[model samples]
Target: MYGLEQYLLSMIYHYRYWGLFTVLSFGMIGVPVPDEFIMAFSGFQTSIGHMNFVKTLFFASLGSFVGMNLSYWIGRSLGIPFLHRIAPFLHMNENKIRRAEGWFQRFGDRLIVIGYFFPGFRHFVAYFSGMSELNYARYTILSGIGALLWSTTFITLGNLLGTHWQGIIALLHRYLSRGGIILALFVGIIYLYTSNRNKAKTHEE
Candidate 1:
């Protein structure tokens, strides 16, 4: 097994619930944890009667919520300077941040809830929300909603898929990765088109 996977598996093997929480919490703070795989694995544990699904969901949700808060506070405190230094580690860059900002401006706070399914997007939007000074109460409410939904969906999926969970999840991960890339390209195209059109109108005027 890969070192990262080994570490993740070791954590759960030794500590169970706490391990789940820790991995997910670190993940939201920009650690490269395959959180869905872990959560689903936990769900598979439930199938084998090794873990309780409700408790698993609870721990996972709590961890995700806590991590989201941590990400927000980091952005709130350090702002753009922190992101500049750490963005590379988190697989982010100026263009992604700009796109996130554009989405935030166009969609408002709802993106915080909707972004959970979009992998790296949720992380960026959380940080952006912090930098933008979104109200803490609203961010928490939305974050909680997102955390619960994300946890429940994946964990439950793991339970239902049983032994085949890993294969399907790996496939799903590939699709989500491709979808994220395609979505980025699509958005970039639209942004360029709009900017060029606006410039044309400005020149005419």
Candidate 2:
């Protein structure tokens, strides 16, 4: 993680706004860069007088918004074909996409917000949002708000924690991993229950 922190610091030190923006833009598009860590580090820089707080916030928010919209556009344009092409890499298949579609119909908006908090999985939210053809206006509104909130929260923490930011990042990563597992299990249980209830209703009818 020290290596990651140094890499991010180097990017910010060398390229300033463009570096941060570029990394986040691509990171959100599924590149392997540490997006949240970079954001938080930018905050840490701000705390140390290396970066302007307002500009860092603006660029981070913009990068996140644009990257997500790009994903959405890709999903809208390519639709299932895109998913089919990339699904293998994502460990997604037709059945999973269909299942996700059902959940999107039921809880799409909330997922957009929740997705921001989940690493790895958040990369797919914009694409799935596009494929699902969620209400465009709402997608924009919700995703925009989510990006702002997500970026701000981490950035502020980085600023507040300063030198201790890395510790928090490590801790947060562990909690997020554990939380993701619990959330997945919960979602699976609900899905099974819903499927069974639907099956029973169909039989009764």
Return the top candidate by lDDT. 1
| Residue 86 accuracy (lDDT) in model 1 | 80
Total backbone collisions for each predicted model: 0, 0
- Kindly list the per-residue Cα lDDT of model 2 for residues 1-205, writing each as its tens digit: 5686678679887888889888888888887777778888889988999889889898888888888888787778887777678889988878776766777768766778777777766766788788888888898998798888888988898899999997898689778767766766776687667767766998999
Candidate 1, run of 10 with poorest lDDT: 99-108
Question: Cα RMSD (Å) per model?
Answer: 3.9, 2.7
Where in model 1 is the C-alpha error above 4 Å?
81-108, 186-205
Q: Extract clashing residue pairs from model 2.
A: none
The numbered model that scores best in TM-score is 2
Q: For residues 163-204, what per-residue lDDT tens digits would candidate 1 score against the true structure?
A: 999999889877877776776576567666765776699899
Clashing pairs in 1: none
lDDT of 2 at 59: 87
